[model samples]
Target: MNQQFEHDDDIEPASKSQLKRESEELQALGEKLIPLDRKQLESLNLPDKLFEALLEAKRLKAHGAIARHKQFIGKLMRQVDPAPIHALLDKLAGVSDTHNAWLHGLERQRDRLLNDPKALEALIGEHPDLDVQQLRQLIRNAQKEKASLGTPKPLPMKAYRELFKLLKQFNPEPPIPGVLRSDDDDFDADE
Candidate 1:
C-alpha cells in the first residue's frame, strides 16, 4: 500500500468522466478550426501533420468521414498547446470583451475617417503595413457614397462597408479591460 501510494502522490488523478469531457471539448475545438480560412489556419501555427489534417477535414463532405477526421484532429490537438488556439478562436468569434471592444473601436475609427480628413493620416501613421493606395480609394469611395445618400438616386452603401472591413484588418488588438471571469473564483490547487 505504501509503495502504491508513493507512485501517485502530489497529483490528483483525473476521473474517466473528466477525461471524456476534455476530449469532447477538444474535438469541438478541432471542428471549429475546420471552417476557418487558410489564412486563419496558418496563423494558428499548427504542426504540419495537424495542418494537413485540418485542410483534409475542410475538403471532406461525407458525414462519417468528417466525424472520424474530427476525432483524428482532436487526437492531434492533444499534442499541441490549446491555449493560443482557444484565444484566437474566441477573438475571431467576437465572444471576448476585448475583441468586441476592438470591433467597436474600428467602427469609431471608421466614423472618424469619414468625418475628419486627417484621421486617415493618423491611421496610416499607426499601421504602416496597410496598403495606402487601396485605403485611400476606399475612403474616397465611402465619402462619396455618404455624400450621395440624400440624393434621389444614391449609390448603394458598398464602400462604407469596405472601409470598415479594411480598417478591421489593420487595427491593433484591443487591450484587456481587467474584467475577471466568474470562473476565476474556482479553487486553485496551487494555493
Candidate 2:
C-alpha cells in the first residue's frame, strides 16, 4: 500500500515570515536594475538642461509626486535620448495617478480659482489684459517664476523661462513668444 504524503501544491502556504524573506530577495533584484545614488545619475553626463530635468523627475519621484515625475520624464524623452528611461516612464505613465493635482502648480491655482467663482472673477477683473488663455499662461508663469499673485508686478523672462520649461515638458509643441515691436532693436527682450 502507498503511504500518503502532502502533495507539493497541497503544502501549507508560506508564513508572513517566509513571505517577507521572499520580498527582500525580489527587492534586491529590483535594486540591481538602477543605481540609487545621485552621483551615479550625475555621471550620466546628460546635457545640463536634461540633467536638471532628470533631477527634477527624481525629486518628484522621491516625494511620490507622480505628475511632475511624468512631466519631467516626457520632457526627458523629447529633449534627450528616449532610449534609457522610456520603458520605465511608459510603465509609470500607464499607471493613473489620483494625486497628480500638485504636479502642476498652475493647475492647482486654476482649480482653486475655478472652484471659487469670486476669486476667478476678481483675477479676471484685475488683469484686464489677460484673456482666459492668457490667464492660464500667467498662472503658469507665476508658478514657474515662484512669484505670488500678490506680487507687485509680472515676473522677469528668466522666471518665465523656468515655468516655460515646465510647461514645455507636458506640451512639447508650445507657442513661441513673438518679437516685440520696440524702438530698441539692439535689445532682445523676451515677452
Candidate 3:
C-alpha cells in the first residue's frame, strides 16, 4: 500500500509539470505573430491584388498606389493583431476617438454642402465639367445607347458609377452634428 501511494504521488507531479510546459508553449505561440508565407497567405480570402500591395509597402512613400498599399498594410496589421481585432469586435472596446471626430467633421461638411449655397456654388465652379446640362446630355446618350437594337451594347455603367463614387469620396459628409438629428427618411444625410 505504501509503494502504491508513492508511485501515485510521483505520477501526479510529472503530469503537473507536463501541463505547465504545454501552457508555456501555448503562451509563447500566442505572443509571436508570424508573417504568413506566400502560399499560406494566399489561402486567406483577401483581395487578389493584396500581395502586390504588401510588396510595395516594403518601399517608402510611393504615391497613389503606394499610399493605398501602406493603408492596406495597416488594415492587415489591425486584422492580424489580436488586441485590435478584439477591440474592433467589441463595440465598447478599443474605439478611435479620432475617427469619431473625423466623422463629425464629415457630417458638418455634408450639412454645409446641402445648406450653404456658397459651398455648393464653389463645388460647381471647381468641377465645371460636372455641369447639370452635361449630366443630362450624358443620360440622354446612355438612354439612346440602351435603346439601340441588334447586337447587345455595353452600358456606360462603369463610367457613371466611377464618377459618382469619386464625387462621394471627394465630398464625404461630416460626422453627426449636434443640431441635425438624422431621420430614417433622409438617405443622403444619414449616409
Q: Pick the candidate with the highest TM-score.
A: 1
Clashing pairs in 1: none
**Residue-wise C-alpha lDDT for candidate 3, range 96-163, written one tens digit per residue:** 45334444565554445434657556766877766655544444453444445344775444433333
Question: Model 2 misses residue 6 by how many Å?
Answer: 73
What TM-score against the true fold does each predicted structure earn?
Answer: 0.61, 0.22, 0.26
lDDT of 2: 0.43
**Local distance difference test, candidate 1:** 0.76
Over 24-101, each residue of candidate 1 has an lDDT whose tens digit, in order, gives 898888888898777667666788999999999978999999889999999888887787677767765656666677
Task: Report lDDT per candidate.
Answer: 0.76, 0.43, 0.43
Candidate 3 wrongly placed segments (more than 4 Å) = 1-79, 83-95, 125-168, 171-191
RMSD of each: 10.2, 18.7, 16.6
Q: List the residue pairs that clash in candidate 3.
A: 103-175, 104-175, 105-174, 106-173, 106-174, 106-175, 107-173, 107-174, 107-175
The TM-score between candidate 2 and the true structure equals: 0.22
Evaluation by lDDT, superior candidate among 1 and 3: 1
lDDT of 2 by residue, 122-164 (tens): 7667656545675456555555455444577745655445443
Candidates ranked by TM-score, best first? 1, 3, 2
Better lDDT candidate (1, 2): 1
